[model samples]
Target: MFGFLKRKIKEFITGTKKEIEKETKEEKGPGERAIERAEKEIREKTKKEEKEKVEEKPKEKSEKKEAIEEFEEKGKKEKLEEKEEKEAEEKRDGLFTRFKKIFVSKKLGEDDFNNFFDKLELILIENNVALEAIDALRENLRKELVGKEIKRKELEKEIENALKNAISSLLIDSFDLIEKIKTELKEKKPYVIVFFGINGSGKTTTIAKIAYMLKTHNITSVLAAADTFRAASIEQLEKHGKNLGIEVIKQKYGADPAAVAFDAIAHAKAKAIDTVLIDTAGRMHTKTDLLREMEKICRVAKPSLKIFVGEAITGNDAVEQAKAFNETVGIDAIILTKADVDEKGGATISVSHVTKKPILFLGVGQEYGDLKRFNKKEILEKIFD
Candidate 1:
């Protein structure tokens, strides 16, 4: 809408510039000298009359001063009231005002909203949104949704789509999907993947999501429980394996995770797995022993791709995690989880640019089906729009 206003203003300015050019042309002609002489004679006559009036009546000057003071006081009051009104309007109708008004006027039902949020929340949380971010998103969404707004007959899903587009513009980067496909195909066979992140950062969950995604694309994946630290870790990977109907190579807790990784790769080579997704323990990037363990696993896996997963609700901590993991293991891609909570949606760009990694997917929700391919351009368009 503003674009239209901007273009109109630009045209008006252009027209004004052309008129000024015409005026300049006229001023350069012979008539301009005559006009200047007439203007000077008129100014002198007006100046003499004003001087005579001032000299004749001192009372007139005092009355005029009193009137000017009253006018100034009235002007000041109006200005103050105008400023207050503007602030109030901005508070309600500022950013997403149009959408809010439409929602409220329509009187959207709670059930209608529930169904709408179900899909949206799943989509957002799976993308690694912070909890607060998601809360902020819901607040904004509800404000625009519950109020009367610009009339449109589009159904709920269409509105949801538009909302998603609006939010996506604030979330991801310009992902060159075609180029990425070509590059992935260049490897020509097995696209091995090594997943890394401190324990509890959703590394294992991310691996499962990617494997499931590949399966949907008709590609096969082999699971490798390279995280040999925690007892539940291997069991967790095994559960994912069972759910996905795949095998998980593993070793005893406190065993060499690097050896487990080597074996996983060997199994993939022997069984001819199309892809290998190695899951490592959730460990702080700052922990040396944990970091060394992750390093060793990557060295042994010799995987074609390394992905770093992080919790989105941790704010800038996710970016910090991305950087540390990238520095330690040379992460090639990122997978952000809990995106349903992305408040500012601010971390997406800073994290990507900081780690210099292409975000592959967003864990928008807790369900395995909630994972989605990252769309970068969609995100950039929303922020600072």
Candidate 2:
């Protein structure tokens, strides 16, 4: 049957080639009749092929079954001849490959904690962590480590713990929401949160994001466009209000931002809004007039919290900005914006440690819901690990 099939296929190949040649010649000559004849022949040949295939199915299946059984017997023999140690060795190697990046030629040396610390310090420095911060970090790490023998097996976890300890030490303990709310309730009207930051640090956006977060937690806030500079500031705050379904009070460009803040606080108090987020102008902390304007806004609003917005990506400049604002308005806390970018590589730790203000939150993205409560553990894991 195999020989007959081969002979048939060869004949079919030659016949098909001849047919194609004939069709091409016919196209150049008397085309119509020759085309019709070739179509008829093709149909007849296809039918004959179908009939032959039908006749061969039972034989093909029986042959396949015999071949499979022979292979099964061969496999059994091969398995019976295989050494147990060799098979076990291969299985062990595969399991090792699953966990290891590349195979070590010999047994690996023990991973010392100090070595891990060196590499981690390098990583932090490479990511633009300030030299002072690094020195402080190293000092803290040394004190914490002291005489501890952190070994290879506990390397991942020990390093994780070190990071956790270091970050917790650096970050100031921020406000308690329940306690703050109760304190504000004593004041017994609107609870205002005044946002302050340098221009381009996402102060307005951070305010909106915080407001959105508060609403999700069932606390409604009124937005204040206290950013009277920047021709687009009013529009930006208004746009946030429209998108967030919150009430926004604004004034014309270059108008008194403090007046705008006063209006929003008054509105929130009158309407019993639980929280008020006021967006202040993006000004340098050094400019006395601009700093005075921010002070006036805070004075008018009587904000429960003065949130100094800082860019996590700004490296040490964030510390400078925060210190400037702290010197000017006496910031209660800081909101680190663009934390998602910072988590990759930035000086959040240095700023947080130096500023001495607790971080209230982190702006993880541009969306209203992207703000996250600053979790030191999460930040450390993302940064060091």
Give the number of the best model, judged by lDDT: 2
TM-score (all chains, Cα) for each model: 0.54, 0.64
Query: What are the lDDT scores of the predictions, listed in order?
Result: 0.64, 0.68
Which residues of candidate 2, in runs, are more than 4 Å off? 1-122, 149-160, 176-179, 343-345
Residue pairs with colliding backbones in model 2 are none
- lDDT (tens digit, per residue) of candidate 1 on 241-300: 999898899888888888987888788778877777888777663568767887788777
**Considering summed lDDT, which 10 consecutive residues are worst modelled in model 2?**
101-110
Task: Name the TM-score of candidate 2.
Answer: 0.64
User: What TM-score would candidate 1 get against the native?
Assistant: 0.54
The candidate 1 region of ten consecutive residues with least summed lDDT is 1-10
